[model samples]
Target: MNKFLLVLLFSTAMLQAQTVVEPDSTGVVKSNDSLVVQKTIMRDTLKPFKRYKAEGVSAVVGEYVILDSDIDKAYVEMQSQGMSIEDITRCQLMGKLMEDKLYAHQAKQDSIMVPDAEINGMIDQQLQYMISELGSEEKVAAYYRKDNIADLRKDLFEANKSIKLASLMQQKVIEKVEVTPEEVRTFFFSIPEDERPVFSAEIEIAQIVVDPKITKQAIDEVKARLNAIRADIIDNGTSFSTKAVLYSKDPGSNSKGGLYTGVKRDSPWAKEFKDQAFSLLEGEISEPFETEFGWHLLYVEKIRGQEVDVRHILLFPEVSQKSIDEAQKKIEDLKKQIEAGEITFAEAARKNSDDKETRNNGGQLVNPISFDTRFDLTKMDPTLSQQVYNLKEGEVSEVFTDRDRTGKSSLKILTVTKKYDEHQADYSKDYERIKKLALREKQIKVINKWQNEKIKDTYISINQDYQDCDFAGDWLKK
Candidate 1:
């Protein structure tokens, strides 16, 4: 299966595949059941032979129960993600399911509240992606075995909410776990010499980017359009949400009528947009304002304490080919200057690069995933990795045009500043990497301890067939 299909299947797994047990009077559970069974079963098995019941209770954790069919579902889920299942056993899958439910049950006991808006927004995005890929809402509903899209959405909401709760619970358990430099040193030396990890060949690169300039005419035209939209809402009583659906350029929110709930002053929104949103009274619309995302008109629907419910329509000014050509020429000139020794690459980047994140730092690109200056050559972004693989240290590459995720185009030139050959891990040279690994180990230990304690206090049961399997946790304690 393709990546998107895998995502769709994983996201909707519980909706189409989950079978909650519903036991009948004869001690057998019915198939195609939807009710959640919470009662505990205490009988021991006479034989360890596998007896596959389509909907029999495989395990129960607190108020949640896993059906026998869920093991099959788990297999399908793993296969969809391109995982090798040859060595994976049914008991292992059941243990994972029980762990998830235990976390979710404990999350509720601790009063962890997942906002309805957050869950609803995720469901909307998932449905939109499925529909866009599968062609229509009808097709999406049928693909997931639902009678209608509404039913699919209902299932998605419950499953997604549970997922968020479990995830939050895990975060809460390990949020405060941290490792010191001494712990990192101890952990690094504890590994066997032969078993120590080999560090991959890595490169540190920097870039100089020049963006096409937007003319005043284009900016005014965009603002004029937004102003017209604002007038229609005020004079003709046109719905702001309807306008957002029809005209908003923000793909993240356009399908949802450009609505964003629970927005706060500290949210990672554009400062200009947030300022305008907070300044407006409920049911008031703000004048058009400019941000890095271009012009936007914001409407405040309501305010709840520190949070606000808002809707917006975003529009970007069009850039002409002439401007793009000028940007290309400008970057080419900078590259030529560096090559001729007229100016150093770092000096040019600091003075001329338009990329805000790197310009002030001498255009040195930081790896977002590792929060470090180095990127493993094999794991770097395909386009960037190809561009810098042949360039020697301090040698500048030919000018190239790059487009961001938003499809905004710019001119850029790259140069590798440093490179490291593959070698065995060194305690002094790889302290950052070692520290990260040590911290992860500490977090895992913390989570394991938390799980053990919770399992002892919670109600849990396992089927006779799985009782013989060696589980990581003591699931059959009671």
Candidate 2:
């Protein structure tokens, strides 16, 4: 049997029948079956058997009772690690389940539904996150004993959807919650000054960027070279991987025989790269193509659902000194115009900047920490930070060299747009911030109320074993 199928079956069996018994109340049954307890059992059964154990007395909702197998497993695992299971069990598991039950009940009451699109989106996101952490989907699948991500997607999707729905319900319940100016001040005062989070002093900056222009003829020449190479590989019966290893300029994957583990559309590779990879059928080779990274001959190896694996040989066209000199002179001329007031910095950026992301925003650089125009000079690029550290507001930086994430070097200039010194936060300075906090508090209350109502009405049943554990909400008497 497939490992994935086994997990799914276990989950279904665990949730199919569950009973809830209220603690400290006799002959008081609210509902007969508890979804919360059933779900918990499913999670426990799916975990590795070596770590399996039961923790805390169960809680009865209506007709359903939920159990904490993970907590039990943790207790037993800790015992194996030389900790006292009694102390750990007595202190944690039961309380935790009570909290989870309250939240899950609230989620159902608020009608927090996870749409199919949301589930699929989350699955993709998880897949990408796993790839980043494990280096590839193949490794992750091997570790989990699954054939592929699709086999695991359904279970992951359901679990994630349930958690998301619960979170949404919490938000809805707390929508009107708030902590006022006084509350903020009190909370701030309660914390020790030494422990307070220090706000970085920052400056706002802006810039104009340009790429050294590549002529159509130069691009065509590079593509023609790649085309020749691809033709040789196809006509000579040479393996694609061998050719890529010998000729590909993509330093990251070339050594691995130009093999790219499957990548999603958003997997940090350029859109052009992904588009070209997906366009080719498995085993099909693409003609030479030119992108920002120069020219490439791509070979699509396999298509796995939404992911594609490909190999490519890349060639970077060398930039001539004349081209660099020309670009530098143009930038210098633009700076002179700004200084002479022939064109305002904003106007110049709008008209000539190559940085599409920020040029339209008046070339103002965003603070990495706050994402606002404001930033602490200390947290900026070491070289650029040093320049801004010495400049007064409104000063334009001298021409400096920098490289982007792709390691492409370029010449650029920066202008300091705004500066803010450190100061204590207050209502006047942070009303919008305070309001958001207050609103979250309100939402929590609403969710709590909704949960109480749902538990009172939903069908729940706890097993006889959990009839005596104290629950936070009135699950048995409702």
Candidate 3:
């Protein structure tokens, strides 16, 4: 479906679409059967498949049992992503599910604690994207076969907890992995010559960013406008949902009546906004409150503990041409200083850049994937990629408007500080790239060993129907 999930959760590419044959089970789905299973199969009342007394267990990893219904859910998720389904693919899928269980079991044993905020943040990001794409919360709910967006959010929270836990465990497993230059060379040469990967044309780019400041006048104007709308809602009895659709600037939330559910108090939302949020009682609409990105009026729909499900009407302070021009002027000045050698890009960035992360580091943009300052060519924004692709090293790009993390329009100029072309993988030139791969290989080896050991110590069982495919960790053996 939407590979738009921030994590590399389902990135396997265009495989042939194939159906997973239904395993022989007494649990044939009935006519009245619905796909509206709860995210969890309830703790005490485990195995809702009791009705399908015929529905057999696929595998059992410690306390976590993989039921026929669970496998069916996985198959449907894969099918949504257009995955190839065969015994091999099914085994791979089973392996992944079991890995999740293994990590979860170990995490509990090790007393690993993942904060609620972290999980809530990830879930919110995905929900925001899904809601934006689907055009409304109603659409998102319907797509997931949920009663509403709140239910969808609850499901996301449950799913993401395991994902986050497994991720944290994986990170801890590889924390100590180290690879030397010698190891990198040995690993590189170990690959068959014909099978060696061809390097893509890549470049290292840096930028000086200037956030367009929405003026005090714009803020006042927006505040006054929202005040009127809020008045209409409370004083004149206008529908809060109706006003949200027409006026809210948050694309992800506007069509949803500017509502979000399961918002954890510890989440990264602006503290002032969140502080005001939790203090409100249900059906209480607060006065206009200011956050970093404009003004908002809170309408608390529901609250449970630290989580608040609320609808709000957001009004972004409008930016005038004058505001845009001012930002452009600042970047152009910085550009001139760089061109004239009056100051270095690093110094200008430190003194003036609005981008916090890059400002301290010479305005160098890190590749989101590699988490390094090098660009992988293809991953760069198409417009940004094309512009710098044609420029020589040491050239600076013209200032242009780009969206920041919070979606604020900002003026930015990129500098091509370094460039590399497609070639055979070389230790001298591709040291970092090769080193990363080599290090990851070492980590994988470590993780695999740990996984095998865990499997040996933990109880595991697989149904005879699923035992044929190749499984790692001696799954079919010990």
Best by TM-score: 3
Candidate 2, residue 342: how far the Cα is off, in Å: 3.6
- Residue-level lDDT of model 2, residues 1-478, one tens digit each, is 3333344334432222222222112111222222223222212212222433444435544322344543443243233324344333322344334444555555665566666665564455445445545666677565445588666565455544544554455545545566766766665555455443334567788897766766666777777788777888779878888888887877666776787664566455556777888888998899877677668888888888877878888887656677788789988998999989898888889899888878898888766444567776566778778767877777788887787543566778888877777654444665554454444434444544665677676665654554454544455553
1-478: candidate 1 lDDT, tens digit per residue: 3333343334333222223322222212233212111111112223221333455788888887777655654453344334455555665566667777887899999999988766665554455456645656688677666699778767667655665677678878878888988899888887767667777999999999999999888899999999999999999999999999999988766776777765666555678988998999999999999987779999998897776778899988889888888888999999999999999889999999999889888899999656789999989999999889999999999888787744677889999999999988899998987787677667666776888899999998888877776555678773
- What C-alpha lDDT, on a 0 to 100 scale, does residue 64 get in candidate 2? 26
> What's the distance in Å from true for residue 382, model 2?
4.5
> Model 3 scores what on Cα lDDT?
0.67
TM for candidate 1 is 0.63
Question: What overall lDDT goes with each candidate model?
Answer: 0.73, 0.59, 0.67
List where candidate 1 sits over 4 angstroms from the true fold: 1-59, 65-94, 142-151, 180-182, 215-321, 339-347, 462-471, 476-478
Error of 3 at 63 (Å): 1.4
Clashes of each: 0, 56, 0
Superposition error at 13 for model 3 (Å): 12
lDDT of 2 at 214: 62
Estimated TM-score for each candidate: 0.63, 0.63, 0.76
